[model samples]
Target chain A: MSDKLPRLEPAGLDGWIVRLFNDIDEANLSWLAALANRCRTAFGDALVDIVPSYTTLLITFDPLSLSPAEARDRLMVLLDDLEPDTSGVAGGQVHELPTWYDPSVGPDLERVAGQTGLTIEEVIQVHSGKSYRVFALGFAPGFAFMGLTDPGLDCPRLDTPRQRVPVGSVAIAARQTAAYPAATPGGWNLLGRTCARLFDRQREDLSLLKVGDEVRFVPVSREEFERQGGDITPLEERP
Target chain B: MTDTAIGVRVLRAGPLALLQDAGRFGVRHLGVTQGGPADLYSWAWANALAGNRWGAASLEVTVGGLELVAEKDLAFAIAGADLGATLDQRPVPLWERVVWKEGQVLRFASPVSGLRAYLSVRGGFAAEPVMGSVACVMREQLGGFDGLGSKLQTGDQLTVHPAGPSNNTATQQAPSGVRPDFSLEPVLSLLPGAQIAEFSGQSLYDAFNARWKVDERADRMGVRLTGPRLDCRVRSLISEGINLGSVQVPPDGQPIALLNDRQTIGGYPRLGALTPLSASRLAQCKPGQEVRLKATGSGAALQEYRAFRARIEDWV
Candidate 1:
């Protein structure tokens, strides 16, 4: 019943926060995806941008063209008739990332294994064992926040974020998992590395992953990882 | 390559200098930030005095130490922070157009008044666009002189796009009223946001009445304000899209004003957001500079924004 309802709150001068649900989960994301699509179609050029996250969508509009009152009225109309896609097929795209769960690149592999009381091989199996849904993208360009990792692989973020997380490092924070699109300071638990270029300006599509997409990490050989352009340099040794 | 022959060459790249345009839009869903000039008012004035339209690429020089040599005869203008700029050992005036003869040295020393200055040539700087904008975002590694989101470097040859027919806007001076006095402590206008009710009355009173100092950990990304630790009932929320001037409050109660290069979304609870011009004014403040925030309504804020836009659109 909560998934069917939505509330709109004003943000600043020209922003509107469409609070769909209070919690983060697969249902919230699906509802947000449906709402995002509708907002784009309904608002058109008047909408500057619609930022979709786990449970809310922040809609910014062009104040010159559309007044807040008018935008609010239109948004209410859309909300009144909003129908979230109950069908499972609305989960958007699915992509598989070939991952290397090795200690050479993933320096935290042993730490995570030790914490979870699982062997290195069992950690890898638990991590690459299931599909994860992308809850949102933030923190950096092309960074996908995928989530709901198995309970065994759950881990807390570092007390202090690393000075530099190697590009393409596959990491997990709590139940969420992501790969560093570009080398940046990060705090997630490093589980492995990926060859996939998550964000590339050279490519036709800038970001490889999008909100609402499903991602599955598949374990790959070290040789295959290097062949696919994955960085094999040890994390600690990298500058 | 040949077209860039008539341009400015970086002789000495300062601590931070980057190319910025209006900003990237319609790409926040990909987690990309809107990278643009931190001080829009100054950047616009510089571009206008150079006879370029809005959204033209200009150089944003922070804390000043940048040195450049003109490759050929060029018309340029400098605005925003004075930065004690000198041309060939003579003082280069601010808020007005000036000529740069071939091989003449142009340099910016330490800040005399403001923290950042805008440098604009007649034709505007040219850089390959990334994600529909030439605004350099070093964090995202997109849009700069190299189109790879790099800051200005020594030996970098900044290419200037060819100017259109000389117009009235060129050789014009910025109105004195529009040029901000960067030396003075600024009172910023804020439009209170959704979570304003969650904060205690005392915190809200302190947020407005207290003099907040800018923290040393400030950059293009955001500026953290050190003041009364704001006590709020809600500590966090589902991450939402952050605007140019979102004033987010972390658990520590210190508020951070998100700026041009901030992350697209944040989970910290926000008290409100600063108006655009107020945010621009806040950007010019040095670390430890005192500032005050005044709550204002959306109607008044929009009116002020439109007036500024109209002034730029229709120059006297």
Candidate 2:
């Protein structure tokens, strides 16, 4: 059955090809993750980096060390012997990030509430209600793309992106929620602010979360946020 | 052990001077960009001249104007660009070995030949490795002389491994060739990507025929080329992992040649990717330089790359 998985033509860039799965869902994500873990464990040094996205995983390797054809054959063998483990979910740390939902902290909270036709408090409630899964850490360093936000709170990104989004900012767009790891230009709809540093250069592990980590946001009062030393402002201001 | 300690004091820092080794590998999953010398050819040559192995940490001086005073006698070599260098106020040749005595000043004025220059000592620079590399990534703030990704500043001290047995004679044949004329028009070789057929016929014609101008909005991440707007039928698609030199054409039609500092993944529709050697050439090009893209198959591209690598192996 694994051998039957669709394999696309090689991308013109040397030693890379596209492997597409029919569908992407929670069940498939687990299968993909388990398969990736098994391949990494089995042929540890053969692979360079295996990045799992929302619907796909890109396994990049050293062309000089291992040819793409050989890598593809190895992947097929690992997938054939792999058993999907659905029970590996729900074991990540529950990080209670101190968020200040004030208008100053969240520049787009009012706009988001207006767009969704819900009160600001209702928007906050819908946002903090459920635990979101960390689909991947990409788009930028320490930027975690957590997902499956409440369908009611889904909002499209601003047509004109904010020139700069502050670090530790909690934002939502469509079905995804993310914490801005650093001050970078972003288009996501800002909902609140968090003091918990999502990325720190001083730490051994720079990113606070990984691809398979689980995340839950806990809203906090302005006083509590201040007490937690959350006064770090964006290095650059948004236009 | 006492004889190996060589020191240099920074008198002036160029636009950006950072200690770089080969690069940090096996950590992209952690969202770290491989921050090494923007020009690998020059970096490798500098190390080879110093009789050090590949991946040794060397000084990556960009847009020149860097000056250093030797605190002790040291043997060093300068490779890469002709960054008007002067040893004790006398013109010192580029891409050759040179000896400096204690208290001698080594100065690199504004770039006369190329954008970046590499200076390597007999012994590699003494810097603590961060994440198994001394390559500096300012954006990520990891890996440098201090392991903090900080650029060299005036008054900063650089420590090098103690001077080894002075092999003042050239051990390897000099790379003989005229410096690439950056002022001349550049022809970039590109390999057509998966979505080549997705582009409009007129766009494809223009892509191959038209001369594009390198836009000023260029950096380590990418260089945006301004030319005929290429219209693609595919407006949007799933974002996937992007490789080095991926030529992504957005809605605006201008093609962006992604480089080392590019994002890990992107969704933009791409025409194709420039070959590795072509990318190295493109890195040195200044803004407003005319560039024409030549379409070549992957097989030919790989063969050219192999030939270059083979030459490198001969030197090793």
Candidate 3:
């Protein structure tokens, strides 16, 4: 890591954006997560929220309590004594999630296979072969946007968005893949369904995936999926 | 049970009625949008007149179709748009606290002036909190009267736990000078944002100089403004969490002023953001109404907000 200082810019009147790096990468993500931790520790109950994205950390505060300049000055002071963020030191919880990749469950599996000129089994092997890192969570609750998928499996979003994508849908868009926390209108290319429920408000920790965690998708059989209480994947294929 | 549960019973429910507090905060990482009252100015005033501190939950009535039959004698106040409200068949003026007796009917007909009206009880509407906010977000299916994001329905009762002593009358009313007139053109105060420099000079000039009309395509999510094309250098930016009153300009040049119920993260480049108070006024504007954007400093905006907050509560 270099000794470069993060540049602070005004996001709005009451908020400020800390630009840690110019692009999204593993190092920048680690740095952003570190800065985010510092801000969280510093702001405590005074801040409204601090949102971390690819290369920027936006800090929004209550106008009545703290002014933007005041928040900025505090961050600047923290920056002076900050240490280089070692990416995997803080968070590296690896999540092994199971996915049912049957044709019925993953409608686009065949299409993705045809596009890559690889067999369905080959695509599954490449996808679950290595652990993918969790870059960020946005769009929906527990919707972790992970990156650097196998180049062969990289694909663009559907030309038109699907009005309704089912819950627990494991899908890919560009080099990124995510599991839909809830059913919503999405444009991602669907590949499979997962038994893992990403979000449950009743739980103490509402989201299973957090920023800086690692994820791996394990392909499971229809019988195994059904045995795990997944109703979407039927035992027998429809004739 | 009846002795402990003193609440007002519902007679009629307007087009859309919901209970809202300040807003949900510190939860955007979960992709939870901040849910709160669309018209904040009115919501705050209503709370103040009722003698409750700020951030209290209040009823937000849109386009005025709500009616309430008081089951318990209560002190309440109404603010925001003149929605043709009446108490027991007599016209009840807005921006003032009115005493209510048991069995008195509080009915709202239609919009005489504004799109939404705020009504606050002496205490505040009682609702189970979800994710730390009682503000209702129907899209998320969380936080409301039943702890689920359901709009106010006919026969739904509103429970209020008194914050102060149950008084027969509230002597305070919004001063005449402080009351906003919804009929005039809205001059929204904009604090130019990060994307302000990316916009073409001509586009920036037109954004402030030209009069823009509020399009019919408006909701708690955002209000679309129809005006001259606002050309920007960048096609899109990385998606970031949006705050209340963030104004994003799309490729079409028209700007959408995002409100309280907006998505947690968005990719569109924002020309700037409206002050919280300006957003409150914009919420009251009807479709096709003309509005102009004015640039203001962030410090001035903070000061203005502090002054407004001081008016309702005992703040030094």
Best by lDDT: 1
Question: Can you give the DockQ of every candidate in the order shown?
Answer: 0.59, 0.39, 0.48
Clashing pairs in 2: B4-B162, B4-B163, B5-B162
Candidate 2 lDDT over B158-206, as tens digits, reads 8887645644354543577523565567788887876778899999999
Model 1 per-residue lDDT tens digits across residues B1-316: 3364448899999999999999999899999999999999889889888888888899999999999999988989899998999999999989988989999999999999989999999889988788999999998889998888999999999889888887674438887797899888899999888788889999999999999999998999999999999998889887888887999999999999999999999988888889888889988999999999999988898888878877877752
Write down the TM-score of every candidate: 0.96, 0.89, 0.93
lDDT of 3 at B15: 81
Candidate 1 residue lDDT tens string, A1-239: 12354887777667888888888888777677777878889999899888888888889988777766778888888888777755532547888999998998898999999999999999999889899888889999999999889988889999989999999999998888999999999999998999998998888878999988889999999999989988888888444
lDDT of 3 by residue, B1-316 (tens): 1223456888888689988999888788777778899998889888888777888889999999899988888878899888899999999977777888989999999999989999998778887788888999887777888877899999898888755664424357777777888988889999888778889999999999999999999999899999899999876877666777889998888999999888877778888789999999999988999999999888999899888877766520
Shift in Å, residue B161, candidate 1: 1.1
Best by DockQ: 1
CAPRI tier of model 3: acceptable
For candidate 3, lDDT tens digit of each residue in A1-239?
12254777676666887767666676666777778778888887767788777677778987777887888898898777776567543556779889888767677788888888889888888888877777777777678888768899988898988777888888887888888888788898787888887888887777888777889999998888888766574323224
**Top of the candidates by TM-score:** 1
Runs off by more than 4 Å, candidate 2: A1-5, A8-17, A21-24, A38-43, A72-96, A201-204, A232-239, B1-6, B163-173, B177-184
Q: Write the per-residue lDDT of candidate 2 for residues A88-178, one digit (tens) a residue.
A: 5545445666687766768788989898899999888888888887776667778888878988888988898888787778999878899
